[model samples]
Target: MRDEWNAPWGSIPELVRWAAVRYADTEAVVDCGGRVRVTYAGLGARVERAAAACLAQGVRPGDRVGIWAPNSLDWITAALGAVSAGAVLVPLNTRFKGAEAADVLRRSGARLLFVTGTFLGTSYVASLRRAAGEGDAAGPLPGLPALRAAVVLSEDAPRSFLTWKDFLASGEGVAAEVVRSVRVPGTAASDIVFTSGTTGRPKGALITHAQSLRAYDTWAELAGLRRGDRYLIVNPFFHTFGYKAGVLACLTRGATMIPQPVFGAETALANVAAERVTVLPGPPTLFESLLDHPARRDHDLSSLRLVVTGAAVVPLSLVERLRADLGVETVLTAYGLSEASGFVTMCRRGDPPEVVAATSGRAIPGVEVRVVSPDGTGLPPGSPGEVLVRGFNVMRGYYEDPAATAEVLAPDGWLRTGDVGVLDAAGNLRITDRLKDMYIVGGFNAYPAEIERLLAAHPDVAEVAVVGVPDPRLGETGKAYVVRRPGSSLTADDLIAWSRREMANFKVPRWVEFVPDLPRNATGKVVKGDLREASGP
Candidate 1:
């Protein structure tokens, strides 16, 4: 018999429209700052206005619009606005530097950018200016020649860029009321999420609206989301877990979202009780911190009915503590990547505590997962191999990078997740390690190649290699082994300081070791595995 839950949903916009009608008077989005709340009607109105503003800025169908901002009501508004304007939304990590941000903007050919003035202690306007300056110098940003304007989310805009209010004013009042004349459906490349590649560069994984919607639809079912349920969103909106699982799921299910710009353990716990948040999903680190917070016992988190965690390997002890202390009955463990548009495997709400705590759970209905050996042969149960995924939720491909796309997407449409895992006889997936030289620190994927590339760019560094070292707080932190140029005396502190200025905080190597030469194999390739072992516990 066919599963009733596996039925296909047509499009994403349908869900948006559904929420507009069903929860018109319900509080849809609540910004913690000043307790700003937007009803479904207000959200729909703002999305249309933002869409019209984007169109006024010359964004046409299929044009990419980059959103480099943190978690906020406006960030979600701009995303829906871009979609309504028939533009593909490109969400850039707010932690990215000007150069890294420029690479994605240039590659996506984003004509317009929507960014916040200040987010998580960084000035986006300043970063945009830095990126724009690179464009003036005929750099990578020049590839996005269509990029002429930036819309900043602030009352007082930057010197040259347009303010969010002013941009909305430019659109005709009725323009926001306009609805799509065409019925779009199922995997039409709605957004592009950039994931760090093993080759040091980033890959823009093109996810259609349908794929994202499918993720939310399936996840909502798994999590038991429903109308009036409130969700505390601490995950960054730029990540798929936040956008698809947290925001979109809430929107589609007529649930309310309590938006938190930054993740602080105390703030999250307080918000959960204050907002009556029923659903909470974040990285394991987030939950651990909240559980370990000195003031956790003082807060009333009893309202939390469900908590989902992913993006890193969660220790079983942490899972047990969540259930014992936090009273979270439906604790789920899920696994997915940007390429899968969020979740391919997940533990259902009613799953046994041990199943939820110890395993990544079964594949979501409609998603097929396989464990394959190096020779492309399928591995049996309990055999570890590179995890391959095929599903409706799989990304279309890397935007404008066919060669790179081909390397990951097999002709049969399976996406090589580069994650090493084994499937038990019960079909639960257990991730062992990454096949690619990438490490997860606090849920952020950091590629050794990327850090090594940045380190090699330093004038004092002749050769460099990076490996992950175990860390109690971050799970895994980068440890760099560098060979300085002859007569160049750079201390470990110097390298750490330099990295802080050059890369994102999470990507920076926590410890730097100076060495004459890196361990190499017979073929002269740096043995990163050996380095990891040498830097062991």
Candidate 2:
């Protein structure tokens, strides 16, 4: 495995091609809903065909291709193909609304977009078109000046869009030589992942292919992901957890990628038992749901060997329960962000439940992690301060936004994670608090700045401040303290309903409190500490 890791591979396509030859007959992907299975050899061919299709569409090297869809065979194929065609892949969060997706599409200047017509009872194409408007009357979708085409992954494509089948069929005209010629370098940008920014907008994080492959290679090794292992990926494909750790990791390890689009406990249990899945990685809530479900024992989960979970705090009892109740041998905890290719500190096997529960584990090989004071000096072990990371895993920069990139990323390569943590003598890191106000809801990052910006647009809202309060189910949910406009009769429920229409569900404040005015510091900044205290424990 070490020798294989040292081999020279330049890009995603090269990795796929090598995997095809090395693990030709090995199962690569299994679409649970479509009941489709593809081998390594077949998956490689599909990626190449998708690349040819992209070339036929006149997509040039370095072009941005946006994929706005949920996890599926088509999603993976489209993403891999675009990257193979030397185009930078831009993945849109499935949780995003039409306006949100359109904003990213416009900012990225994506020439082509692949969208799911419908998923989980919502029509994405229809919603985006509605947001973008119809025909010449709309005047080029407001901000999306470069968006020329969209391919809908459905039976019928929307107006001015191509169907999935037709999009692939367009490749028939492009010669294989054209696809082969568009070779992207390993150090070049592979994917531009947009994460919620502190400035109320999403910033694109440019990650290279070599960094991605290297980061996940160490990750797979630490997680005990082995050849022939059936990996049930419940994590969203948009995030690095699913795309890099789930899809790319499978290609490197010859594991079977069984993508579970939406996570439901009953469905997950049945799939684990039926498919004889050996590995399952998701947030702690997933395992909690599985354990709390009544029919958990009904499924034969004896094949389950590895479980990797992080993001939210993993209760000590949950870690113990996962082993005692389910017989999962190698349950590990990890920590990372989208900027780091989702590779950072990870707990090793055989660690005690207390250590696993309290700390995020030690840093992965080649990554440097430090707890630093406000002065940028490294703090002593056990002293809580900001967590700073510098390594091969850190992204090149936020795409096309050098000013915003300069704020968080240092010239010395240290990335200010905005997370506060303490390192033990053993080098295990225990996250104490966050320097930033960002919070996680069901493993998804919900930035207060982004949510507050949306809420501030409300006609009834005069002033607003958002904070993260503890929640048993989702780990943490947003609580908004709002000062309403004069004589406005807006109820908490009313504001919630209005927010639902304006923003993504995760970003919506679950709780609303009407206040005369927010408690402010001398600098005229809202004191979130006071609001958090007022909201109560």
Clashing pairs in 1: none
The sequence of per-residue lDDT tens digits that candidate 1 reaches over residues 1-537 is 122334334555566666788889999999955369999988988887777787777777788899988888999888888787778889988788777787788877888888788776778777766766644433223445768677888887756577888988876654434545534555567888987788888888888877787677788888888998998888888888888888888887889988788888888878887788888888888888988889988888888878888777777787788888877777898998888887889987677777787789999888899999998899999999999999887888898889999999999999999999999998999898887888988988899988899999999999999998888888889999989999998999998998887888889999989899998899999988889889953
Model 2, range 321-407, lDDT digits (tens) per residue? 989999999889999987888778999988998999998899888889999989989999989999999998898989899988899
TM-score per candidate, chains pooled: 0.95, 0.97
What are the runs in model 1 whose C-alpha is more than 4 Å off? 1-9, 134-144, 173-179
- lDDT of all predictions, in order shown? 0.82, 0.87
Compared with the true structure, model 1 gives a TM-score of: 0.95
Candidate 1, position 95, lDDT: 81
Clashes of each: 0, 0
Among all candidates shown, the one with the greatest TM-score: 2
